[model samples]
Target: MELNTSLDVVPVVSIALMGILLFVLGANVTRHRAIRGATGNQMPTDPTDRMFIAQRAHGNAAEYVPTLIVLIVVCALLSDGWWVQALAVVAAASRYVHALGMLTSKTLAAHGPLRDLGAMGTYASGIALGVTAIAAFA
Candidate 1:
């Protein structure tokens, strides 16, 4: 079988960047937990406000990154069109927005407009990619 090089750049770069972001967020949470004197192997039971924010941000990324990766790969395989690349770009950007919103907000549950928009954008990109995949594979 032949290999396709088209549609590879954006998704690959996005995946790498997401990995870096996850690592940084994870480290942030870990360091904060240590600062709170919870250096044991187990997670902190009572996280501070900042700890909560970091944990939630990392947790959100852990939950969504895999799905984004899968969808991006599927989109790349199905087509290397502008829509596919746009979805990849939007997915990456939304994650940053969400992370920033989580970090800057008063609480994890009370994410600001950036967080809301990021979540919506993420879902929209995933949905668009799924539809595109279906249309291409069908």
Candidate 2:
């Protein structure tokens, strides 16, 4: 199978957006930590704490974004199908939604609709991208 030499705009945009989101989340965590200087607890254990929430939001994005970006890039490289592009967009959107949910949430332990929807979208898009990549070989 021949690979598409041209750049895939959708996947590229999606990847860039995800990268930006991850960076913002990480910056938020750092900002919170810096605000709570040496005298304050550097590592907050409470889920309700703002610093803890920021840390979790950044950590969660870090965990999922890299894998999703890889899957999106692989799918785009393997195939130039619209489905791949759609999945990439959905994956990126889900990550944003998840981050918003986490940031807006009062506590991490409680279930939030945005978080649930984002998680479901993430799973669905990721699975679809993986399947599409595998099918491209056929």
Candidate 3:
């Protein structure tokens, strides 16, 4: 069966790309941990710099991507407009920026400019998207 033309593709495309990114980040963490001899029966709680950054980047994406996907899908299903597409773009960009920031930071918890901006963008976009979905359905 052919894909529905009216079904928005933005959310699918955006989330797919984010999934790839998250996979790459996870791979990087695994590779670094293995190279550094940090892997064993349990994951390293205090990993090396590269491992820590990659893990955080991947973990952060894991935390947010599902929610973003849900919001985008709901918005696309319930509404007929550009808002869903726009939010998908915002969510994707936010995750990329966040990963970049996470990888470049000296400390995962420290406020790097890109990290802060990306986090704020993610939160704002997510909130707006959730609200939009509610408005669309309600």
lDDT of 2 by residue, 17-101 (tens): 9999999999998899789987898798898999999999999999999999999888888898889889999999999999999
What lDDT score is found at residue 91 in candidate 2? 99
* Per-candidate clashes, comma-separated: 0, 0, 0
* Regions of model 1 farther than 4 Å from truth: 1-7, 39-48
Global Cα lDDT for candidate 3: 0.79
Whole-model alpha-carbon lDDT for candidate 2: 0.90
How would you encode candidate 3's per-residue C-alpha lDDT over 40-114 as one tens digit per residue?
533545543567667778899899988887887777777767877888889889989998988888776567888
> TM per model?
0.86, 0.96, 0.85
Between candidates 2 and 3, the TM-score winner:
2
- How many residue pairs in model 3 have overlapping backbones? 0
Ranking by TM-score: 2, 1, 3
Against the reference, the lDDT scores of all candidates come to 0.80, 0.90, 0.79
Sort by lDDT, top down from the best: 2, 1, 3
**Which of 1 and 2 is the better model by TM-score?**
2
What TM-score does model 1 achieve against the real structure?
0.86
